[model samples]
Target: MTAETLTVVDTGRDKKREQGQAELVAAAVEAARPGLDKIPDPVEPDGDGDLTAEEKERLDTCIGGVELLSTAFWIAGKSLDTMAKGHLIRRIPHKLEPERYYETIEEWAWLEYGIKRSRCAQLRAAWALGEVLAARGYHAPEGQVRELVPLKRKYGLNAGVAMYEIAVEQHGADKVTAQRLRDLVKLLPEDLALKDNDDADQIARMFGGVLEHAEPKALSAGGAIPTDVRRGVDRRALDLANVLNRRRIPRTEVERHLLEAFADEEDTTVFDAVLARMKENKGK
Candidate 1:
């Protein structure tokens, strides 16, 4: 075919795909409504029971959420009620005839909404973090929202929000980014994944001491922290090895010798406490 004909053919294919996708979206919403309406009266983890008034209210929320999603995926980007959407999307399955509708939200997301489970999850996290940040008066864009997601996942949504506030307060939201957030989260004690402690100031203070010893360059973004904890543990282990070398002790013998010395004690709690104290006082 001529180049002009080829271009027209490709354009036709694009139009066809677009039409099909639009139909798919409409169909998904159409399909979900009946199932949502039929939601067996109750929508708990197990679907055999009936729904309470409170449960019915929540079920409406889920149904309303899908409607909102159909019209405005960008509802996720909006500050108003964005988290409610995220929370619902994260739990769209809602035990609504699991065996009939589909076993998991991921399956429903794929077959019904035509959205990948990964994108579904990302929207859920990003919306949650974004709303939390918005509550703190920062309508963080997707970039910053994306950064805060890891913080939310690692700690809690409050922790993520707290971290965003800290970052914006430190560097202004425009200047801050995913990389900047990652840097901040990394400096947080390697073990700073506290779910219950969402206090921003308290969390901000967590890595404060690490700064005293960490070089300025050390704070520069290393791009990203590995999602796998083992990678971090491995790096920390290597650093510990270097620290051990400074003390001129063999790695294996240190623990072995400690056991030998503490052989008389059935419980090593006393030694563990001492070692913990020594770690706490390392700089001093």
Candidate 2:
């Protein structure tokens, strides 16, 4: 046989081998993935119409099954990380351009489930947090760690990490249950002002009364401000209150200061000024 013919045959064989390997990998992933019998059919009416009886039944069944499965997984101490990763790996190959599978598991989940990518990511993070806590010897109750996932997002990753470390060190893994962890996270110093104090328990109790009274009211649907924006405001207000309490500023005085500040300026400028003042005072 000619050298040219031999070279062409070798290249063809290599291509076939690569294709076979890809197919095998895809099949293995698919086989390992959770069965889809648990997921409900996604078909529904296109517009502002109600679902048909069949659709409604399917939807209800799906939701119920999902809730049951979720609770079961949580109770069984199964990590959502495993589920999320397996789902992405299994489904990515089915896409027309599988090369884009590396984008993000959350994005892939959105494509597959039609849920918001951010929500999917939050659940994934919760599960991952559970794994992290477990590995750190802090074995919280089955679903306890997951409950802190939203707080993790709210407080920021660095804050969450610091809280976990501090909780483990101060309270010990056994003592840091879900509720205790929540309380501990709430007691985290908003800024660097009070971090020098090692008494998390004392700090939590000191601010607990103020925090209880400062709970944000439910936002009305017709309100101009978005829920997230309102939550941000509430968080800032809480932070300010913490700083004030740390400085031993009386509640009535803090209220008077806010009234004066708002009377002068109605915008976020007032908030910024107050926070700056509080931080400055804390410095002294």
Candidate 3:
């Protein structure tokens, strides 16, 4: 066999050493089952007829059902993808695009699990799958899979890179670096454009920061650092670094005031501060 083929064989051996073949197959099988969208759609709002208490409750319950199923499928799909890649590795390569796979898997799990409105079933299933993978020595990747959603739109879903595209348009690399900021502050598309140059001017005043296009860094101390934050926020930051590159924030500054805002120590404080500052400056 060629060197490359030898490498594959060696790597395959390494994977087996890392996690046994039997375990991987088991994970793949479990991940594939319980396909998406098993529940019926919610009832239409009462438009022509008088509403009955039972009818209203049923409709409400169904609406909740949709929400729960969607969330569970999402969780299950994420967990399965991770497990598949970690376990199966070369076998049963996932031909389906990442995002498409996610949607499809979610639908499958929703139907298969018969999850209730509480979404307890889906969460349980995902958690159980995660536990199984963990027991087999599998771990999910740190960052999310990008564009696995899709580059273009289809089936009424937006492009996978839509968020990045919007971030690029609005803040450019700033979007990539400060992804956590954008999400935490809940900045809108309109905010993409500087609502006012004055805010930019203020940021310049405080931190010597200006929005510029450049590669971002994996993690930087240029912004306020927090000792603690939700696992979700940290994950977003890591994702920002992974997707945008670590050098995205080439020349930003952190303000003491921003750090002080963490006085409440909410952990999400950095986001709160940045958001508050942005809004405060926007009004000016």
* Among all candidates shown, the one with the greatest TM-score: 1
> Between prediction 1 and prediction 2, which has the larger lDDT?
1
Global lDDT of each model?
0.60, 0.56, 0.41
TM-scores of the candidates in the order shown: 0.42, 0.32, 0.22
User: Which portions of model 2 show Cα errors greater than 4 Å?
Assistant: 1-122, 154-158, 168-171, 189-284
Name the lDDT of candidate 2.
0.56
Task: Give the poorly placed runs of model 1, Cα more than 4 Å off.
Answer: 1-99, 193-195, 208-284
Best by lDDT: 1
Candidate 1 local lDDT, residue 271 = 77
lDDT by residue for model 3 over 41-112, one digit each (tens)? 556666778777867776666666554543454466556556444553333323444433333433443454
Ranking by TM-score: 1, 2, 3
Kindly list the per-residue Cα lDDT of model 1 for residues 1-284, writing each as its tens digit.
Answer: 89999999999999999999999999998876635454445434635588767677777867765544423433533422343344444544434555443445556556765778677677665775665555566646676677767767767767777777677767887788778877776655444446484576676565454433333223222345454643454356567768777422222233345456556477787577778888989967
C-alpha-based local distance difference test score of model 1: 0.60
2 versus 3: better lDDT goes to = 2
